[model samples]
Target: MTSPQAAPLANAGPALHAPLLASAQIVFAQVSINFGAALAKGLFVSLAPEQVAALRSGIAALLLLALVRPWRRRAAFSRRDIGWCALYGLALGGMNLMMYAAFERIAIGIACAIEICGPLAVVLLTTRRPRDFAWLALAIGGLVLLMPWPGRAHASDPVGIALALGAAACWALYIMLGRRAARVGAPNAVAIGMVAACLVTVPAGLARGLPALDAPVLALAATVAVLSSALPYVLEMRAMGQLPSRVVGLISSAGPATAALIGFVVLGEALGPWQWLAIAVLVTASAGCSLGTAPPVSKLREEPLT
Candidate 1:
């Protein structure tokens, strides 16, 4: 008789659950970030991009500090840990600054699409499968079509594209440092890194007269902090620890479409029919990924903040 273990189970344990949950985590992160972007655009008319970055970063740092209370467990991390967190924070700050700068000069979806080039490069370099290449090509094709190229006679601002590229570089560094920081475990690592980020941003805001502190602006900034800075960092960090960077990067390719939809809704930034078709291709590409088999079971064991 065959051993019980020898039999193939129709559905077994967390085999079905873990990847689905991981995919959901990624999708939720994309949604939260773009909604936050929409809110940010409303404030751009009142505040400069750098000023907005300072506000969002500072508020997010404060919120994360309160929730994590990293002060209580300060002794857990080594000097090396501290260094990694510092660098991680710096990368995040740079990314924020670059993205906001790009946003001021470009459309939301376009800036987001350009910023994604960083992570997409990381994924392409690390991946070996031809299938992964096909997926990446499809997603990228959609993005290229969506972007209003210079040759199309409506040249996008070169400075804006440059800033987006800078943000992409920062994002690549952020992802690398983020993975290292994740090993330092939850709240302590994230909280400390955010503090470092605050150092970069808060000072800039003070120099700019701290517009985010005004009564009317403060509320919106707080919401932006929650949805964009706080939620995405926390959620993405969690998922990064569980999934391979390439897999996470591939899944995040849906970001442009998500941003486009949010921009269309909140800012009335309408997309042409071709843009809609591009969005559909992005969706199809992200869906076609092997999400179920990408992250192994070992990844599911999260290290608590404690």
Candidate 2:
């Protein structure tokens, strides 16, 4: 799930008890997201990728609004706050749109691996430590290996690859804006921001599915909304509250690999050895960055955004 307000925590201690249960919660968040991606891939056949992304964002906005009730804080938000939310929403919309476009033509694992370059760039820019350069370089090299070439001519669509990279850029901006939003607003900013996201994406035919009414597709889209957005947000917040930040980073770093595995198991998309190795390398880079000495620039206090 996307971090609603900002980045993951900067400090967390190792678990003291019930490690299995705690780890399971974070792992479930990862699996649920990837599996939801797989489901979204199937929906792309009937609905345009834009349409699917729109429905997911639109429905998620409504659900989050109902759950969060942003109006309760109506007097709390200022013009500057609304502007930040709009920017955050624009980034969110672009990220999801580009991601879905990429997902339409690429394997889930490949798309996810490419999209992760966004966060990697964010970490790199935030860090000043020279030693982490090695990890960053390894990540870049891993991405190179993942490119479609030589024996992997059919690994991914060229256009999809481009879109994934764009999604990466949007995701980097999303992180920065999210941090700003967290400062002036609470997690309810997620609800407010999603409204702007809906404003941006809905015009791209978000309601197209409404007239064509099919039980299965409607059900599937709803399920995607809950699994990809609602459920993971809840699970991640809980895990973040209980577990150490380092542990969360390490476990969440498995995201790319988990996506690949889920793609293979659910969609029958298998990659070559180099592709898997690429996934491994990128994942390692992410884990290393999470443990980097670049102190978190985010000044937001670690408190529930309720």
Candidate 3:
């Protein structure tokens, strides 16, 4: 018999179900986030990226507070768990801040393509399976096609590109940390982390986007928070409980493609044939992963939120 931890690697037992569900939840989570971000981007055109991030995090914090009331269960966590949660929250905040910064300088699709590196790295690092490398290669090749691999003759902001990649690294870290935190319970860990992210973003937004956070913008930001963070977080937690991590990670590779679609449909962006092909590669890889697994049996167990 396999140890419970090893169970997730192979289709060992009922535990394999959790990773499978986690995979599906990951798709739902990324799609929801991309769509919500698209909506928020329009509403936040007048606002600075910092301001928008602040509003998103602040609103998410309030919703999480209302939902989990972390203070009410503080005694439940050990000091080590508390430390891990805090680190997780900080990573979350940093990732968001950096991603918004990236978006400010590049096209949304381009920025997302850069950010994809984070999770892809995670997938590469953990697996020794040769078959999985094909997916990894597909993801990388797709990213190369999506990125402005053109020389200096036609380049965007290098700093912005760097920031987007940084966000990707933080994203990968966030996933790893989130999985650890999920072991501490998704809702509680997320709530605690949001509080930390809130601390990081709210102040920065206030400092940078004070004028933009007035009534109308505040309302828009609130909506963005609900759409981009709270709702997705809730749904993802539910989905993760029923999915597997490998499947979840694989599905999440579709994030860039979803972001591209959101940009096209909502933001009037267009894609060429090669770009569309890249999207196809990513989506097919992700969907193939999901299809390979069966539906999970339960919705109560917590799953990965990355």
TM-score-best of 1 and 3: 3
* Model 3: lDDT of residue 13: 61
lDDT of each: 0.71, 0.75, 0.69
Comparing 1 and 2 on lDDT, the stronger one: 2
Output the TM-score of candidate 1.
Answer: 0.76
Predicted candidate 1 versus true structure: per-residue lDDT over 1-306, tens digit per residue: 666775555345566677667778877888898989888878998998888888888788889989888777768878898889899888878888888888887667767766665654555555677876786788788667656665554445778878977987887777677677866775677788878877777677678685635788989989998998678767777677566644664566678778888888888877566656766776555444434224532122121110
**Which candidate, 1 or 3, has the higher lDDT?**
1
Q: Which lDDT tens digits does candidate 2 get at residues 175-246?
A: 778887765555566777788877767777554554354988888988888888778777777667666666
lDDT of 2 at 34: 87
For model 3, residues 1-306, the per-residue Cα lDDT tens digits are 788887667755656666656565666778778877776677657888877887788788889889888778777778888778878888888888888887777556666766766655665566566655776677667666656666523344678878988887887777788767766687888888887887677777788845534688778778788878887777776765464544554556567778878888988767677667766775554444333333331111122232
Task: Sort the predicted structures by lDDT, highest score first.
Answer: 2, 1, 3
User: What is the lDDT for 37 in model 2?
Assistant: 85
Evaluate residue 111 in candidate 2 and report its C-alpha lDDT on the 0 to 100 scale: 79
TM-score of each: 0.76, 0.87, 0.77
